[model samples]
Target: MTPRAKTPRNSGQRGGHVLRRMRASTVYLLLSIGALVSIAPYLMTLNAAFKPQSTLLSTQAWTPAVPATWSNFTALWSQYDMSGFIVHTAVVAGTITLGQLVFTTFAAYAFARLDFPGREPLFWGFIAMMMVPQIVTLIPLFLIMSHLNLIDTYRALILPYVFGTPYGIFLVRQYFQTIPADLEAAARIDGAGTWTILRRIMIPLSKPILATLATITFVNTWNSLLWPLMATSSERDEVVTVGIAALQGQFASELHILLPAAAVALLPLVAIFLLFQRHIVRSIALTGLK
Candidate 1:
């Protein structure tokens, strides 16, 4: 009988490494499939953007042979006044994002670090607000807007965020809690006041969360429709979402005008998301929250 060759002891370790790598590869494959599935609709819209009106309204699904049409974009710009819509959207979204960040940051810092009477209760109250359906406050918010004569203005679009969002404060505060007290203590020993520590130390260190919040706020404002529609009855204050909806409603059957307008409305949020995705991941990792 031929002597069997002995397997080396290290062969077991090598086999274990191979098994681990196979598991990792399987995990990556699953994640890739999920990502592609999530992105499919957006990809379809992108393809639709370049296709002609005839192709867009067709019952068929995605088609690679569809020749690109620059006219769809031109029609989008001229028919819908997309540039104006983009500007309006940008103004409202940018203001809300900046305002929310400033107010929420300060509030979050206070909740996380400062001790005072009623602080815990107030924070809990804010958390409770997050549970309440937003629709419950819509009528009240609208009444306030009407009384303030902020109707048909960016002010109406922006006012809600200035008061601060409960979720925003919660996110920042959670992240702030993870930061060691020693950092703030060091700032205090160096003659930094509350505002100074917040501005110089906390804010800089919280860039990841801040960037994430701004991205979310920007997307929310940019895509907002009902509030913009209710607040601004005219195109003068119409953001992209409202503008796109109005264009589709008016055009009805005109894919040439409607589809491209929809595409235009989508591009800004996508661009911003891409730019800040790293910060978004870091924020989620650091905060352990969405």
Candidate 2:
């Protein structure tokens, strides 16, 4: 038999595979570097959180919390009102999330599905306000809260956020619009009222977006600092972030304690993001599909 010849196609395929692998490797290398850079501060915070106060000054910056102890965390809970602050923050965040879910969903549904007068204009107005900095309205919010005698109260923390955000309305509205109108029209053909259609058809299909909204709202509210710091004075009203800030003066020399308290405030948001990150991305993808 004549010697078999290797075709150009085989070599081209091999070369393409090689090039693809090289590109993938380069992309992975860059991503790995970026991940490390992003996580470095968090790793350092954990190091300091577990390091003994005496060793913190002596140890190098990159030193691990060798023989790591839970004393800092224990002391944080025992010495400070951390537990109460966490519970209070959770309550505030939960209330705000629930409120946003209700109000934002309703508003989004109306804008998306209804034919009310001024609907488009109102929605565009909401979109326009999103460009305005939160700081610009902070004073007005504070005055409203003060006038309502809500300062230093849970109402102050919850009220400002409970009405839903512009971003939330926009996100949910976009997602709502993506839902097929056929399903809604079919429901109406069966004599379903708007409320029935929204309740049964719309909400059930909206779990992903709602979950995304809830995660974002809860994490943002949990990490909220400036407003809480400004609005709340009493330890009873203060959230963990504010409490952690107050520790700066008291635990200035105690790196372990201060960092651990900070870690407590920081880690919840990090964990929430890590857990619900996929939902967030999925929601965005779905919203942008239309």
Candidate 3:
């Protein structure tokens, strides 16, 4: 009988370990570069907001101010109606976010779980609405508002959008479908009705997707410009987006003020993302699995 020789294991193991490390390092490096590229413009905007006019016009506009100045912000809040615009923006965004949450949650639950006449057709019809360019509806919406004498009012600003959006409904409906139907069946066996199942079972389970939808609604409503401009003629009712646009036109020569207003307008969305980033990431991962 002859014995066979075993191959050496050290080189192969060390080479594979080293290869894994190299791949991980490459991934991290690429992600860091991508993050920097995405954030650079925001950094420049915030930096320029604090820079003096002299520095803003210079070639080194991206450089951080030596000692950051608050004059631009002060001027915007005092000389213009920036503060009021911010308040207006917050109210509208908050209202729309809340409305979408309530309406979308119920609507999605029904579409996902309930069986009704024309259910499939109605759901697809809503999907079809998403493809219709929003601008085409603007004229009809305006005419309705005008006839109702709601122009330049908060209702005019909020009414059209406070209803659930097709995207919101779709997002929530898909997420709801991902839930285990067994949970609802068990709850029903224990004397739970539709509302009980929704309030206790579904709502808690849907938090991540709801948070994602809320953040999106708030940001989109805050950033809406065209509808606000067309719906509200009064400066007192102006949103930050519309206000910033007006400032850009009027203060075209004043980069200092314009930059500060623009930077300040971004703070709410940044705060929302920072606070809910975990939920957003988790929901996106869960939804991706769908």
- Residue 222, model 2: lDDT of 89
lDDT (10s digit) by residue, model 1, range 9-77:
799899999999999999999999999999888777777778877767674447752578888889877
Instruction: Please provide, for model 2 over 1-290, each residue's C-alpha lDDT reduced to its tens digit, 9 standing for 90 to 100.
Output: 99998778688889999999999999999999999999898889887888877787899857988878888899888888888888889889889999999999999999999998999999999999899987888899899999988899999998888989999999899899899999999999999999999999999999889989999899889878889988999998888888888888888877777888878887778888888888777877777633
lDDT of each: 0.86, 0.88, 0.92
- Residue-level lDDT tens digits of model 3 in 78-117: 7788889999999999999999999999999999999999
Weakest 10 consecutive residues of candidate 3 by summed lDDT: 52-61
Per-prediction TM-score to the true structure, in the order listed:
0.94, 0.92, 0.95
Comparison by lDDT, 1 against 2, better one = 2
Q: Which 10 successive residues of model 1 have the least lDDT summed?
A: 57-66
Error of 1 at 103 (Å): 0.6
Which has the better TM-score: candidate 1, or candidate 2? 1
Clashes of each: 0, 0, 0
- Order of the predicted models by lDDT, top scorer first: 3, 2, 1
